[model samples]
Target: MHILVTNDDGPPSNQSSPYVHSFVRSLQAAGHTVSVVLPHIQRSWIGKAHIIGKTLIPSYFRPGTLHKDDGVASHHPFEDGKEEWVLIDGTPASCVQIGLWHLFQDRGPVDVVVSGPNYGRNTTALFSLSSGTIGGALEAAVCGKKAIALSYAFESREHDPEIIAAASQVSQKLIEKLTQDWPEDVHLYSINVPLRNNVAEAKILYTNVLQNRWTTGSSFEEAEVEEEVDPAEQEKEIREGERNGTNGADESSVARRKQKRFKWAPKFTDVHESVRAAGPGNDGWAVKEGIVSVTPLKANFCHVPNIKGEIKLSSKTSISGDQILASSSMPKLYAIIDYPDPYVQPLILSAIRSELKDLDVELISSVQQLPSPASPLLQYRDYESVDFEHALDQPRSSLLCAYVVRKALIRKHYLSNTISTWLVKHPQSPLKTHFKAAVNFELDYAEFLDEALVDAWDLNDSMTRNEARGNDNGNKEWWILKPGMGDGGNGIRLFSSMEQLQSIFEEWERDEENSGGEQEEEKEEKEKVHSPSSGNKVPTSASYGGTMTSQLRHFIAQPYIDPPLLLPSRENRKFHVRVYCLAVGALKVYVYKEMLALFAAKAYQLPSHLEVDLSCHLTNTCLQDGPSREGSVARYWDLEDTAHGPDWKEKVFEQICEATAAVFEAAAREQMVHFQTLPNAFEVFGIDFLVDSFLRAWLLEINAYPDFKQTGQQLQDPLIGGLFRQVMKVAVRPFFDKEAEDNDSQGSSEMRLVRDIDMGRR
Candidate 1:
């Protein structure tokens, strides 16, 4: 193949333009005829610009006859007879034009144009948009030829010849392959090769340019001039350059510019930091990871598809270039919508569309179905994984690089048992006033159960407490028993006496036995019927799915708060505030201000009988059936209309935030084993809180993957939708997009940051 080679970095020298000579030699050694053309001086960061009115003067360069003082030898006249390279007094793009249409005609129509093997990397949008190396390739591509822009990424200023040679060979192999089967729509390719020892064996991946911006001050600072500089010192510096064989007209001439000049010194430290914080799978990230990157693009600006009208006809339906780029460049989101909350699934997808804007979203169904390499956002629906599985077992590092797993570690038990113990341990804690006293124990263990009963009656602290408390009296403390892992009002019972609590356990045991017997009877009936029909034994699989009472061993009983803050407006119905709190990374907590006030289906009343109607007590919307559930929820802020004072709601919100911060702090400090804060994971918790008649908020149980359906249609968009939007802004977007733009350090305007355990970024 005949190849035309041009570069933004001019002819080879000790400094700026170093690798082109070795690259050309490697191509020649591979038996490809090569013609070289380049700008007389380095013209980097000059994007596809042409010197409009100036005549492009050309000069020739010979391989071995370069003069000692000829750094810009091609700037002057030279014999064109036996010279192999042609240098033009113009831009890199002009070099491609002159080489293709004017100089290289005698070399037989060039099959392809190879630009650079540049001095340094051009990967992200910050560099690619200004890259003259890519500009030259774009020029060639527009002139109807295959083109490739090549760059060598360096860690330091020093260049190693062995690594350069290895990178050249890799480039040659990739170029041949690309040119052999080049796509029709792809005009040019921007290829970046990292300058490292193992570059020969480096994997070449097709990647897209990372769209990043310069947010660290400015690239150019005001050039400072020393008023009292010695003229002799400046003259000496000139002599030193002349003595070193430079004519003071090479790439280093930028330093020799007159006074009051701005230097081309970019704050490279800031760029390096951005690369460190960049998400995986982009061109910049690939080069930083020591892999080769190939980015295909068009020569002209991308054409936007018509989103607001009639469709046009063509040979066939085709995707727009912008859509193609988006499909490949945007991160994938593996989402699962298996949760029972009907509103949550759509709300999550809607939030992703509105907040994230673009992503490759694949709706999956199971945890076992998580794709290879894993999506950036693994939005799982299983609560058990968030509670124990993922928290205990760390995910692979490939999935940990700026990834956001769906599950977070703070579980329901954490709020009850963990916070209760933590408050007891720290007597001076402010949370002691907000959290309720609870006794946690395994229902299957008799000793622990007895101990919990004793703790419930305060038998260990005061034996005469039960005797002083009358039987079934309103003065006696009522206890609400809940399964540790249960949600949606499952396995919960209200009891006042020790006999009532024990009978509740007995009832659960009897129900479990009846369920087991039913399953056995069904299994036997199936076997007996299939034994004659198939004449084969039917397989009996061990039953794993069971009622929550039979499956979960742990349970907690907390003192039921009477005289719940009842609103006069709906006939004084009992209600609880469902505050949405977001936990991100390891870890930062934010409380969503648009809370939901979930009201009980019936009016508030103290239990007069042991068999109590829970609808009068429990405010969980799931406990209400049909049409009643729809009217059971209202915006918590709306309660301000009926609130006793104007600032009463605000004070309750502040107290809620304070209690939330303390709860998470206690979890992180005390229950690190149960609540392992993974940097790649985040979760939104539905934390319940009950307020007394005095407006003092009491902490209730926490629920992960909260039921957004309970928020109802009226407040779904404002509460749940806004909650997810802020969640993405706080937890999901920062890891994958531009940090300066996407990293919401303040979370959102409404989601207040309550707790931040600054582990320092990993």
Candidate 2:
């Protein structure tokens, strides 16, 4: 395969991204054609940002002629022409974009786009989304090319070229093996490795992205002492004459930039995986064990709706209620759909690169960027973003991206958003009407299962005649209100009466209206100064009630759970569980074996003071983990610790599995009609569940994207590092498994029963 490698960490002239040359050599050693491009300076933390309408001047390093210009010089290849390894000064994403459209336009379709070997890891959702290493790969996927994002983890911040050089061959081998039978709907693989001299050979671990984050932001401080700065003489310098190219960076400036004596303030705090959410199989855990973590990620976000499930009634029966779609050995045209969501990202992609045995197929995307031959004869398989029209011209015939499902405007919130609560105790799903909730019961917190009483209302809704009558019981009733699209307990309020709820909504809506269309004043923001006085604020230690909240999208109302369970280990603070589930093609569901337990930021209490203490009712980590909140330090514990010993623990896990399976089954039954599976498609959901005082788990919120601003753990790489490996095996690897030629027979009968909805044939 011909590979083009690039990075946001730039040009050889600056000696940045010290591993680029070795990486290119390794690609050549593996018998693959390689091309390279780099920015002029380091561009870290710039996620998918592009320099549009601006020309970038990239100065190339002249091999064999070392001048006192920029940096290193080495003999690689294609140096006779100015066109090789086009070093354009641009963003990482822009490099990939330009390489595909302009640089490689005459070289034919690029077989692969490899980005990074970045200075640090891009594992957690927070870091990965912000990393140029990942940004490049995501851009390639966006443009319909096979892409790989690579990162190396190390204790030392200094770049280690020898270690990177040594790992190059290993990386090629592993990447080659992983891409052998890549899937259709899946498109990207994120790999992270730790460099250790003592370790000889390393095994790769499949894992999920750790949902973790940093606790503090950077601050400037006065220098306490003068420190020595490294001279730029350590790096080799080369001069080149290219149009719009820079001659070299100033030696004094470079020296100053590398200084170690600068004083920085407000030391950063240690990372805290959202309390109660860490598991042994995630990326953080894998890195600690010293292994290469490969996460299969996708760029699609859609909720599949429609499933006509065949129900089989039974108590504790391990039987399925749906008829399996029979497999047939038939020729099929392949189509792919890719939809990228800004905040919600896939940890890895499972798209394979080749055809299965006796399978005549061509993989393609709907986007019109790549060069296509005139009247092609191969079976054209097109992969495209959600908005484009496929070449097949058959609506719904194309396979959607691995993480996306059949989505409709109204169904978006109803399935995975706040209203997801309706599914748990859905009136039409099943049960003795015990599934009752406001607009949706499925999304209700486990602790609030039976606590749901009031129906959901809107801004236009008013008091009914019966409500106007105001019975004695009505006055005593209380309510919990939240947004259908919200997280971290941002907008939450506790209400004592309908009148109060209305008043609060009015105020909140007014605030929203005033702030909705406003843009950030970047110049003004940068000009503001922070001082000790500004940091100080009046202190308080009480929870209050009455109309108060935010997250004002679609509001959900429920009766407050009376006397909810509180963790004894956490000063009687309320908490809940955040669980994950895999719904393969919307046919079946598989729940993770572990869960996170996020504790409330503050002690449990009723609204008493003037503040509506969101930390008390909402257990989202971000809402309560900050220093601004008054709590006994935010914490999370594994659910294993919460189980009632071995035997009872088994029961608890089994119940969770069954409940989760039942919920997805209903979703499938209601959503199958709208599903158009084409051999390759799947979805993984991060569904949060909460357990009440009665020890019952209620499905609370369904998060479409896995957010790591809080739960991402401190490990070698990010969390998806290990989790995505499992996803590949379970979700996208079988389509090309000639050995498992008869595997389709085991689709619905498999132990996990992740519904494999092959569009036409398997």
Candidate 3:
């Protein structure tokens, strides 16, 4: 596997730098192709700002590769022909872009992007905006790539060989585990190691970002001065100076004279005073108490509602967007396939039809045979005239269906009527309803497709340009592209750019337009080519042509939120609330049950300018010091441990539950309007939210599908089983009994009509 290594800390030098060469060599020793890209100058503290105009200029420097030096024990063994050096003039983020777009252009896709082995620990507040490390990892995540940012924490400036060795060992172990069993859809991981000689004894704790603060207080005062005179020297000096009338010996000498002494008094002011008052249970407190912290992060910042309600048939019904099913009455399932992944339409349709056994489920294809094993219950039906497969294969009607099928699905679900005939007889129906509907599923899909189109074009252009320039670090264009309809981060791509994607979209559009009355069978070939069955390679970069644009219609751009900086005056540090919800006893009961919260903090010196901002920044355990190069100083404050004494913890917990309940309410209402269904079943959503200094809560993204895997081996008796059982009870049960009854009656009527026709013939 090819490995791409990048960092925010410029390039490495011949002189000893623990991070650069050491990290590269380790990966190389593991038999991976390692490429390094870093800033030309330190771009530390500059969060996600891309070059707007003339700011971004390309500069080429020497490459830093493995070198054989006699002094360092970590040096590579002298190999006669191997050259080990590289240099690039770009920010750490730029390095990742270059490696993906240019350096490995011919080599196919890179396996992973690793940032750091940073000099200091990047935990809690520091993790969010630590450009020196986290920035690189974030760039990869945004581009839809699997990435990891690694750092080691030490007690002091002194380098401990044992700690270094231990960190290296852990890195290797983690890489092995992650490479073999990394979860799908997860793009990045932030890992921190404690600087202890006993790596085994040092606990590897998985924790959330702690909201804490460091103190910044100081003062200045005037010094006291005293003057004294020496008798013999003063008399002689005064006699000599008196001839010149320069205030010589005698009276002047006695007054001004002999010796002068000054006393300079310096006082130490506690800049961390405010932070100290924050009490405990923050990331800073944990780190101060000596514990390693690891926090999992997400790229998408949207909420995933447990349930949505919509007015349907004069009754209020709860629904979920994921539960929305497409009508099976349509003969042909229109699908877009760019890569090899065969469209899994058949499987999805099968799943839905299995759940709705009474409904008419038809499988139409231009191809004579079905792609998968035929379902006995879903009767594979044939249509006349139109060869949907052939039409799908043709470029004439491709793009149109990309729009048309989506339009059809939306109309069917919203109006509860099939729009195929309406679209033909009234060709302007789609136009009339275009963008009028508040909730459009196809629109979201289109948004993502458009972004992918742009990214694909940009990637191709950037690669071509980089190849021409022969600059190894100029390829920041390759990206991982994900489809909007895709879930669990599936249907991803390690694509080059927009040029390759335009043809695909154009073909899809053309097909839909030309195949106006074509039969489903004729269009099977075309549909098969673009189906999800064909394995799609994940794209490397999120941006196209270096422009920041959302690939998916409903997608969002994510920024790195630095973990809060924690001061060392407390016990445990870092804590986060994980609220869970369920529909119990038919009343839609949501609960904030379990919390995997912990205390942790980063060790960092605050700049002078950010002091006030730091205090007000609502120091959670997640954010570290902000930019304070001028007079401003970013301070860190802890949350007062009102929880332990006098019911503070319980009170805080109750408030968290209330806030989560509010979020659920908002989400449920929005979902209701969108899905037009009743909230009947139970769903367990892990909502992660952060609280500020004033105890004000800000919501992070909601995880619709939270992972059950534990970070450590600290599971107790019930552990995940209890949560799983609760979720399974709701997920397995059929939520829409009314719809099912309606379908059954309709089926019975059809059967009776057939029987009556037979009897009349007799």
Candidate order by TM-score, decreasing, is 1, 2, 3
After superposing candidate 3 on the true structure, give the runs of residues whose Cα lies further than 4 Å from its correct spot.
13-17, 54-85, 213-291, 300-762
The candidate scoring highest on lDDT is: 1
Candidate 1 per-residue lDDT, tens place, 202-270, comes to 877777777777765545433436534443443333333322322212232233344664434344444
Ten contiguous residues with the weakest lDDT in model 2: 316-325
| Model 3 lDDT tens row, 601-643 | 3222221211111222212222222221111111112234442
Summing lDDT over every window of 10 consecutive residues in candidate 1, give the lowest-scoring window: 534-543
**Leading candidate by TM-score:** 1
lDDT of 2 by residue, 624-680 (tens): 323533333232233334444435445545556655665555554555443333343
Ranking by lDDT: 1, 2, 3
Task: Tell me the number of clashing residue pairs for each predicted model.
Answer: 0, 71, 163
The lDDT values for all models are 0.66, 0.48, 0.38
Task: State the TM-score for model 1.
Answer: 0.49
Off by over 4 Å in 2: 1-384, 387-398, 402-436, 439-477, 486-490, 512-553, 607-610, 622-637, 640-649, 670-680, 708-711, 714-722, 738-751, 754-762
